[model samples]
Target: MNPVAVSIEDRVLALITEDELVSLTEALVAAGGENPGGTEEATVAVLEAFCLGAGLETLAEEAAPGRPNLTAVLRGGDRPGLLFLGHSDVVPAGEGWDRPPFEPYVRDGRLFGRGATDMKGGLAAVAVALKALKAAGVDLPGDITLACTVDEEDLGIGIRAYTRAHLGERFSGCVVAEPTDLGTVVGCRGDSYIDVTVHGRSAHSGRPADGLNAIDAAARIIALVREDHERLQQDQDALLGAGSWNVGLIEGGTGTSMVAGECRLSLDRRLMPDDNAARILESLRERIAEAGLERDGFAVSAAVTMEMPGFRTPEDHPLVADAVAALSDCGVASGIGGWTAACDGGFIARDFGVPTIVMGPGGLNDQAHQVNESVSIAELVAAARAYALLCLRHSSPA
Candidate 1:
């Protein structure tokens, strides 16, 4: 086993395997940090131990009371390093599971469990990739850093904290190890939440005309939102297409006997890089104002509650070419693709001006957050090899 005698690529390919990937993924799934009520502490602990054992310098920081973000570094050179980003928190496993969601198991070649696809599987691939790179004895000119954070499935507090804290540090590039089915995503649509509240006077059913109706105002706003969504289709990008909207939640009417005093609408907006959330909100507010809902003390107010910017990297960027090449070399044939789903990578790309791409092992639309959430064993191994290759190639220029 002469390190100098063997090629780095060969060594990395040999070291990463489906068994190892599964072992790590199963452990991560078993840790069970479902986002709504649960915390990422258990998942962070698992990642910390793995990072330490793989000879990486691990740093764990509490994002919230029990939620944590882990940054593990494979130290390389003086220059900015490559960032491999992921999240530890997963969406809560709701009803409709064939078995317990957190109990990881393999069936037919797929690892099934909550977060296995969206994305403890991706987490394991990231860890395995870093481990293989280290075990292969590759001397990266730039460091390869793995940052697994919390709250990606929720409001994105984990990534925001990481970006704010590392404002002083820079990176050559960022690879977000999200479930991208081993495809490299150059453009991804971002997400945002907006809430519209209407306040009015409640009155008895017999005297409804005497009071302002908030539910009436809310219905008008919903129609307006539909129109706005239609207007957005005209402004489209080649990669990400058009931004869209959905009224995901609505709360109104206290009882059938009284006119509703208040109504609230929670909106989900998918954004492209060109769409400015503030401007969109302002425009929406203007339109709502014109609706004249505030006659006799009924008024509607809307504001953006959460936002993650979307990014589109030019297909000609070196980062895109490099990622495609790495996956191709690993026998995962994929090219530059677009992700309609949003991810934390947008924060890194928009805020830090880093070249970022989302790539990993599972299917986004089908597997992630589904009842039988699962990821292919072979895909996980390929993702690891591709990630290792990307790290090696990324560090070469620096």
Candidate 2:
């Protein structure tokens, strides 16, 4: 409904070419960049090449080889700056695909490939936006920093290292180009991975009564944790909703013949702003104790294997308002929502306290990480323009 948004949207649409968009998508998939922590050389190479092609100066950290995180700065006039964050790494291509997962294919106007909807499409859109900005000769009011990081799928080690070591106190605000179905993602749930180990006694199968079953103890603990999570659901927030937990993995028993002496369970807990990693762990420990399994026959211990805190920007925050205005200017409706999934935005928001938003092309149920995962070309073009307008608006003075 905003007239300014319509103009910006038209400009963005005018700049994105179908051939160019297709080529970028094809190139990214062809690069065959897989693995987290950015160790995949092919992914790093593709990102570097794309940045250079877009006429941006790219820098990579030397501490980790093959796994490189890149940043490029586009300078405008004196105004508050904006940082665009993304990752080049895609999750491993699991089995079963209509076509080869790495080989890009277009059908029904949608580009199908691994990482198509999850992120590579978003990356390509940013590239196209940068190219459009240069071609349009639009005088930027401030600077724009585009950072393509590594290892968002596994842990955010790549971006974390880069931010801590290099980009300390550099930008005013940031936007993580995560897939949000072209809607404004104002917040998301925080996540922590905990490893739980239960100990029991191993005995010969002939005398099963002499030994305890670690698997049984773990199952009881899991049930108690699930029940506690359901209780936590009553405390949901309007944006982030209630925190939750899941027992992602459980392993026990050395072999079928012997009673299992030890079992391990990996818990994936999503936290709300009211919760922290330590608090979540304590709650789990309490639940285990309540299950009456705290004796010598059963043991429980937890360690935070990974942690990514959640954050949100006030609806009226300058960064949030500016981004909404820009998206509106680009002919898109401006609304806010929360993402259940985690991204590097957590690191950016938690570590730097920057007002960060997640906005990108593609739908929420595009079958990401599934066979025939794909993104529509129309969405890609629209996303490119949105990114360009956001860069222009944020890089401009108030």
Candidate 3:
């Protein structure tokens, strides 16, 4: 490692102060008001407010009427840039909590709130690290881009639009600040959402035999999918493991005394490198055919609603080596591993073809999306140091 690079890393770690981290967290929790996924207008408003307060240039892209995604840039020297990606939206705060969902609370050295562990904590930590680096007069050799987008908990329209309209060929690498238990995540499984609809005739329940039931056809289709899931496990790929399928939602008959006229099943499929949307649709069609549901009376149609492909950076990639060395300087010992859950890293890696990694504070099973979701301050501080070190190691002049 270069001496100057090591020195920069050490300085960044030292500069990540406790007050800075606390302020960032406070701003995040204050801004991340009530509302989850689809209803994140207030949250976006708070994020924009925080950005303006920090004197950072804020750019908002309207994904919908009131829903907007935010992007802010922390200027640095001329070099290859790094993007810090995070999502402002979080899952719904279900029942059972000591405090309200929107009201941020700190207790027992941990921050308790809805978005604390799943993502907001990580985002706050990144903000604090950048603030410290700027204050310390350490001119980064590269730029730091911070993007906190909406619709990550439901649909990723924010990232999709951003990548399509902007950032087409700008960034060098990206780090999705998702909760990875302070571990480095190098790759993730691909994901696709499909809606399968089966059509049949409707008749009076008294004469059920007079009409073909779409519900029964849907049942057959579900069975075929279960079998397909097993086969997918057998044909698992090396990096992504087994391609799995889950029937998320099913809708059928309307009236209690009527035979079902239509049935629609929503499927969530985790794909491997070898699997694509078209191939998965074809497989579903083949399964329907094998189940003898290809006739006119029983028709099956598939529509792909969303897709995010899996991605991996080679172990020898420069970005990977740099990240590992930075973590080692922070006294962390570990190698990168695959993540079971998907994030915007898929978009960065697959769409932009950028070397992306998912790394941050908090554990994987800290009751994310639960009533009492929380993140330890120690973990938050450690993550801030790690991210600061990462910037130093990657941005120092050679």
Candidate 4:
């Protein structure tokens, strides 16, 4: 802790220089930790090198094979600390870019690249903030840890493994630096991927009476799915609003001359905090059977392939209040909000038993996983200042 009490905001704001922020952000953006290719190895190396250069005690361990989670600890007093969390992985670049996605460059005050907005930029902001706090000679009462994990874009096993190993440890709080356009996020919707397959008998099209059309049977199931989604509109949460589901894919039919023998539909369901994925899946199965669609040469089956739980931190939690105050300290107008997409923070909230808040630099849902992705340079710098202030306020001795 500082010998004399002063404005933490001013100290933090003055410490993170503009040139350092831009260079760090660009380096992270250029890493290109695309998950579809595989979990990031190169990105982890870059983060490790940076931490070593900063003289922070760092650890690089594999959460999964070749998928590393890097943690840089700025040790302070012995007490519960704050964890600044972010992921190193990004979704694969599909197409459409004015320049190469991996070559990060700045133009018109925005940093452009594949992972610039979704999270790598946020990680860079956290890194710079921690370095600035050290350079300013500010003493902390508790440790400040920065964790950049892998495989968040896919199954989230990286965070899951890391949290599981560190379950016994206590953290004062955690801030998941997922882009929220500088807003503080307190809750997020859960998501599940369901595969529904409908079976039918095949017959020649010339003899329509003999054929049990699988496509026709699939139509009934589709109707029921749509109706269930509409009914789910009544199940709402204060921050997340109503639960929702969408049929993203449907495939059926062997040929134009034959009745389809099978149909498969892929569903994406978004659940509120209290919604149970197992119960929801079972309900879908029961509804299909109860509707008498299982007979008459029509059979339906559904399975959940991937799922991530939702989380909501109470409004009165100290973490939420602290985050709001931290943003104010940095001169950014921020309010508590909800994120519509599922993120790894859910695992820390549910499994690790830590109070978590999500905040970072860019428009989270708008610019992420989109063509020509970019992040505002100004927001990047401001986020670093906000994070530094948060540490000064929360991790300092009373």
lDDT of each: 0.87, 0.78, 0.77, 0.84
Q: Which stretches of candidate 2 lie over 4 Å from their true place?
A: 1-14, 36-39, 62-65, 77-79, 290-292, 395-398
lDDT measured at residue 121 in model 2 versus the true structure, 0 to 100: 85
Model 4 stretches with alpha carbons more than 4 Å out = 1-3, 7-13, 208-211, 395-398
Q: Candidate 3, which segments miss by more than 4 Å at Cα?
A: 1-7, 33-37, 52-55, 237-239, 395-398
Against the true structure, what is each candidate's TM-score? Answer: 0.96, 0.90, 0.92, 0.92
Best by TM-score: 1
TM-score preference between candidates 2 and 4, better one: 4
Candidate closer to the true structure by TM-score (higher is better), 1 or 3: 1
Query: Model 3: per-residue lDDT, tens digit, 1-398?
Result: 78886676676678777666766665576566344436666666766665566556678888766777788776777776788898887787778878876677778988887888878888888877776676666776777778877777776787887787675546668888888877778888878899999888899999999878999999998898898888878875555577799999999987889999899999999876446877888878887887788674788899899887777777677777777776676667746887766787788777777788888877666556777888878878878887777776664323
RMSD of each: 2.1, 3.0, 2.4, 2.5
Q: Model 4 residue 332 lDDT?
A: 87
**Clashing pairs for predicted structure model 4, backbone only:** none
Please give the range of 10 consecutive residues that has the lowest summed lDDT in model 2: 389-398
Q: How high is the lDDT of residue 164 in model 3?
A: 74
Candidate 1 residue-wise lDDT, 95-148, digit = tens: 999999989999999999999988898889988988888887788777788888
Q: Candidate 3 — which pairs collide?
A: none
Instruction: Judging by lDDT against the true structure, name the best candidate.
Output: 1
The CA lDDT at 91 in model 1 is 89
Error of 3 at 164 (Å): 1.4
Error (Å) of candidate 2 at residue 359 is: 0.8
